[model samples]
Target: MPEEVKAHITGVVFQVLAKPGDTVGAGDAILVLESMKMEIPVEAPRAGTVSAIKAKEGETVQEGDTVALLE
Candidate 1:
């Protein structure tokens, strides 16, 4: 099964820390988001291989928007 990582706040994608096929463990930081002058980390919810990235650096994303997927 694949897991989608969603944004918790409306923000700009500050950085992408993982690429497709990258291995990630639960709680691993996958990306960073900047919102309201605060930096928030988007972490992996489960251990899996990164399957897709939907948000890119400088891209704007809203709360609940899927930023990446893992399988």
Candidate 2:
């Protein structure tokens, strides 16, 4: 089954820390999001291998948007 890493708040993607085919653990920072002048690290919801990146650096994302796919 596939899982998703989602944004917790509306923000612009500041950077992508993981790529497709990368392994990640729960609480690992997968990307950074900039909102209200603050940079927030988006972490994995659970341990999984990254299957795809759905958001890019500098892209705007809303709360609950999928930033990446994990499995």
- The best candidate by TM-score is 2
Worst 10 residues of 1 by lDDT: 1-10
**Candidate 2's error at 66, in angstroms?**
0.7
Clashes of each: 0, 0
Prediction 1 global C-alpha lDDT: 0.94
lDDT of 1 by residue, 15-51 (tens): 9999999999999989999998988999999899999
Residue range 1-71, candidate 2, lDDT tens digits:
79877999999999999999999999999999999999999999999999999998999999999999999
For model 1, state the Cα shift of residue 42 in Å: 0.5
The TM-score between candidate 2 and the true structure equals 0.95
Q: Candidate 1 clashing pairs?
A: none
Q: After superposition, how far is residue 69 of candidate 1 from its true place, in Å?
A: 0.6
lDDT against the true structure, each candidate: 0.94, 0.94
